[model samples]
Target: MEKVKRKIIKIDEDLCTGCGKCVSPCAEGAIEIIDGKAKVRREQLCDGAGFCLGVCPTGALTLEERETVPFDEHAVHEHKKTLADKPEYNITMKCHLCGTTEHDRPLLPIKAKGESDWVCVKCIPRLIHG
Candidate 1:
């Protein structure tokens, strides 16, 4: 595996907010949210095409000519396959009432007054008692 100077995505961690807004537009799945920041997960998967650029709100992503591996279409397809095999929405929900994410507590799906929402366990007491 030889490295060469080529254009690749440069993610400025100082500006990235881990919003995950730039993840989807990258058809190659080259970028991902890691530890509350946007990261270039694999240099080889990034095509340096800047397709993920406009979706970024923070202007944290940029293209620069640097020493890196060349883009590989094979790796991108394999990466997408691995992702597809995973359960859908494993990242799941946020409490509709207070924005409490399931990352903090379990979210239960419920409906009231013809509206449905995901509510966290702590919020359940308030919903029932109020």
Candidate 2:
């Protein structure tokens, strides 16, 4: 693939805690935890939309424009298909109470104030009682 100047995800290893928090929000399956740190798994898979930015606990992920592989939509589609079978990548919803994501644990379906939301097991008691 030809290198093109485009905005893509950049990971600062020093700031990355290897929490894997940035993995779930990436719709393209671009980020992955490898060797205990979050790394851009594939340049072509990253659409440079920065969807994974707000989910990071640490300031590890950033979008930088430089010469790199162009984002491939077809490749991302194929990648997502493979990830659909994986349990970890399946759930992207976060806990409405604590903001915990499926990357941390499976969220349960609940109705709050006639609105549906996802909550983690740890917060179930709190949501029910209060």
- Count clashing residue pairs in model 2: 0
Q: Tell me the TM-score of model 1.
A: 0.64
Candidate 2, 11-89: lDDT as tens digits? 8999888977667767788888889999887889998998777666666778999999888999999888898777657
Give one digit per residue, the lDDT tens place, for model 1 in 55-129: 577778889999999889999888888776443213446788889886788766665763445688988998999
Error at 31, model 1, angstroms: 0.9
| 10 residues in a row with least lDDT, candidate 1 | 84-93
Worst 10 residues of 2 by lDDT: 109-118
What are the root-mean-square deviations of the candidates from the true structure over C-alphas? 11.9, 8.0
